[model samples]
Target: MAAPEPATATATSSPRPSMRWRVVDIVIASVLGVAGGLVFVLWNLAYNPVTAPLEAFLPGLQALFHGVWLFPGVLVALIVRKPGAALYGEIVAASASVLISGTEWGPLTLLSGLVQGLGAELVLAILLYKAWGLVPAIVAGAGAGVGMVVLDLIVWYPGAAVEFAMIYAVSGILSGAVFAGLGSWLIMRGLARTGALSRFAAGRELGSRAES
Candidate 1:
């Protein structure tokens, strides 16, 4: 029998992801979106009741929930590293929430999701689709936070006090950093540890470090 050719070793040995979209990726993204949406729904349901006192006392605390919806979108973008990943995940989540529980905002919720997702998406895009460091992730979260606030203030809280608005905005940015940025980073790290994301950039970076 002819001898089989020996595999050549190179400085880098990461395999290319298949050109076609993997079922696992789609399934994971979908599941994450749905789960994130469920969280948004629950949060929204509980928000008014939970924050009513705060809203009455402070007048802008209720807007914090706006940025909560951006977490899953950022997570999906960081994991998928594909164009529209953030937008799709965010839109799916918002749509799911709206479908499950009707909102007076009507179609504007979808628009907010689109803008907020784009905010995070642009940050990842500026990173040249390469680095997924904590700084960039946090920046993406902040961007989404700012985007949501801009939309909400203009549409819903136009008459809110400047101090209230500032507090609301800051709270949203903080939430985005904690929930979307830190939380998503942790999830990615966990996924990398499990070897499930071995095909993505985040996985490769963590994998290389683990090997070393």
Candidate 2:
């Protein structure tokens, strides 16, 4: 009688890492994008009116609201943990906002979305898509904020005073870091706890915690 060879550790381990999006991944990512789009629309509607007082208080302070538009990238990237996830999520979300609710910014909004998504995407790429945590979230949010401000300066705020640009940039960074960064992390944690993300790493981590 012959005996079978023992399985190597490598052979028995999980599959190699992949950037390819599975059907489930696309579905979940699209759902997140659509939800983000709806929020973007509402935020656009309320932005001017809600920030009127702030705009009056400080010309550039209203830029604080910029973070709301940046969240989709961070949230999707963290959840999907895949290449292009941030860009795909943000662009789709932006397109949805425009198609569903319309925006005064017109098609330019799409460009903004592209750039912001790229910002977060760049961060994820830099991290090699190996980490999804508070620090990465904050960095991604801040990166999105930087992309936003650059475009704003060129497209909408050219010739603006240095003080105004600085204020706008700083406000945006802070807002993105707190509202988008921390906010998305909290939301992901909640979703993971609910097991809705069971197939994802974030969900699996929480699932393990429950068992322990």
Candidate 3:
């Protein structure tokens, strides 16, 4: 009988992500960033009205909104699969928030966004920017959440209680998981389903799965 083709060879023959950036990637990232920014603006507007009562009842509830600003960053990073994508997306959203809704925190919000975006970006970096699997997504989300807690502790809530701190941290992590990690993953999946991401890992994964 003829020798069977090597599985390794077959696997290697599969398509992989390219290092080069396309015009479409830039345009898509920019659009996602702007859309994320708009969402941030809307969230900012809604936060005060919606969370005011919660803040009055439980001050820790404020952290619930912390992760809201981070979803776009994750989404963009996942889609673009590039360095600095998270940071750019987040900063753009922060700028939009600032332009649309002036805050007493002033420039500090921008700084916070940068820090949080970097947190998630580092996780993707550690993964070598190759895998957007659930584990990495969760880790990225947790990283962003932890970043928010640290930032808040140092700058915004210096004298917070231990219980409140725990609550805040947990809330931030959960929010990151849901809003940033899984949310971004879902968006990628949806885009893949539409065949819009044929050039990326997300697209290839979906394509392979469909082929199987």
Candidate 4:
């Protein structure tokens, strides 16, 4: 008797458009966004207190935690694997955060979310939304981190010294790369293992790995 064929064919061969967002996509995306937003609220409250020691150690190093705010973009992009997934997820999360918990930046938080989400979205677009591997995920996270620091420089720290700005930007990139990129990828793999994402390629890939 022949062994069972792997279920990775549809993912590898399907055209991009065929991966358009479905109802489930919308539902799951919304859930991720809302949950992420709640996390953002809690993180917001804890941000200054948690980072005070790091800031005292090195003024701009607190940006190391910036990735905490950027996870939804990377996570949603990996899970949804469609155009605007990152933007939609991050934007929704940001908006929800504002509505539910309020943020120091007020409406500007929405803009930050949009731009950060765009950063990851652009990376995914460059990959043609076809790849969900570690490299792409890291790139996407770095992109968001870069976008984040740039926005912060303009809006929150316009008068900050060049050295401070530079440190902030670099720290943000590394943090986003690790926390958002690597973290999201790990979370996705875990979800896949649980069979919660069985309908997605991510889950199928995990299954393929196990069978190998």
Candidate 5:
């Protein structure tokens, strides 16, 4: 028989999972979103107090905490491993936040969620949704951070000084990479260790390690 094309062989050997969302996927994703939204509520209450020092030290530095909002998308995508998982998780989370305590951004938070989710979604889509590693997590977080700053500049920081905007962008991106990326990866690892993710590929990866 003739040899298979390289692309065909590669795909056969390393197939990606289904992009379809199953019931379990929806349940777990919604749970994560609600949990993240609860955290968002607390963060909203604390944002002013927590970031007051940062702003005082340097304007736009308060954005250092923006990662808290970005993690839901990354976390959901990491766990669900499905197309649109990031966007669904983020929108659900933002909706939960809005329904619970009402953010200053009001309904606009939904728009923010859409933008941030798309940021992470685009990166995963580019990779064909095959990568689930630290590097990809960090890159996804950075993408979401960039989306955040772009939206904020238009809505929240309109007419902000060039220096302040620049600082905000840097701080936001750094925070997203470190916190959302690293934090979500760690959380997944922890869940895998506990066997909480046995149904998911993330958990199965660790399961083999434990068995070995």
Candidate 6:
């Protein structure tokens, strides 16, 4: 099959919207970033308590929950459809989380967020920000997952067993694809339906679908 892309058709005769950031874009993007950070803060608080048993049961099962940290970048990119949206959202969210809840990694959490955001951002760039459908979301999430696991392995699982590495990697990808990718897509759909996203193309895409 061909590489995945969204079918966000625009009129050939119409001018394409500028990719430059708008004030509204920044505001909405910040809202998403803060929201994502709140989720991250909650996950951070619960992580050890939740993952201790899982790690004991299976060394890498905790990676399954890693997706909880991945969606903000993607959700921002989809909604904003602009360059750096994913990275900006991810960093803002990480900053908020650190300021509020502080992680074991301290300020290094920002670096992790940057990597994850780049993971999603790179995919969007590859597609030239033209695709925002399910496949693109999943692919972007998968990209973020890869970034997450690479950093994780380097920092947390260094000198770990091959089996652990393999499991962690696969689980991370799956988690991102589901929680970050599919999760964000579903959230966008709901937001569109509620008209909260009416100012965005994502929302317009939903409207076009319903009308058809």
Candidate order by decreasing lDDT? 6, 5, 4, 2, 3, 1
Clashing pairs in 3: none
Query: How would you encode candidate 1's per-residue C-alpha lDDT over 1-212 as one tens digit per residue?
Result: 98755665643577754434466667777877888878888987777787788778876766655557789888987888766677777888888777777887749978988888887888887877666788888888887887788887888788888898898998887777777877788888898899888877678889999889
- For each candidate, the alpha-carbon lDDT, in order, equals 0.78, 0.88, 0.80, 0.89, 0.89, 0.91
| lDDT for position 141 in model 5 | 84
Provide the TM-score for each candidate, comma-separated.
Answer: 0.80, 0.92, 0.83, 0.90, 0.91, 0.91
Count of clashes, each model: 0, 0, 0, 0, 0, 0
Q: Which candidate achieves the best TM-score against the true structure?
A: 2
On lDDT, the leading prediction is: 6
lDDT (Cα, tens digit) per residue for candidate 3, span 1-212: 98887786878685766756778878877788778878887887787887788778887877776667778788888878888877777777777677777877759888878888888988888888887787787778777777777898889778888988888888787878777888777877898899998876678888999999
Residue 57, candidate 4: alpha-carbon lDDT = 93
Question: What's the lDDT for candidate 3?
Answer: 0.80
lDDT of 1 at 83: 65
Worst 10 residues of 6 by lDDT: 4-13
How many angstroms is residue 33 displaced in model 2 relative to the true structure, after the best TM-score fit? 0.5
Which candidate model has the greater lDDT, 3 or 6?
A: 6
- In model 3, the Cα lDDT at residue 148 comes to 72
- With candidate 6 superimposed using the best TM-score fit, by how many Å does residue 13's alpha carbon deviate from the native? 1.5
Q: Considering only N, C-alpha and C atoms within 3 Å, which residue pairs clash in candidate 6?
A: none
Models ranked on TM-score: 2, 5, 6, 4, 3, 1
Select the stronger candidate by lDDT from 2 and 5. 5
Error of 6 at 195 (Å): 0.6
Tens digits of per-residue lDDT for model 2, 1-212: 87766777678899866888888889988999999999987887788898899989999999888899999888988888899998988998999998897666768989999998998889889999998999999999888888888898899999999999999999988888877788888889999988899988889987898999
Give candidate 5's error at residue 44 in angstroms: 0.6
lDDT of 4 by residue, 1-212 (tens): 98767867876795644667899889988999998999999998899998999989988899999999999989988988888999998998999999897656767999999999988888888898888999999999998898898898899898999889888999999988988899889988888899989877788888999999
Clashes of 4: 0
Alpha-carbon RMSD, each predicted model: 4.4, 2.0, 3.6, 4.9, 3.8, 7.3
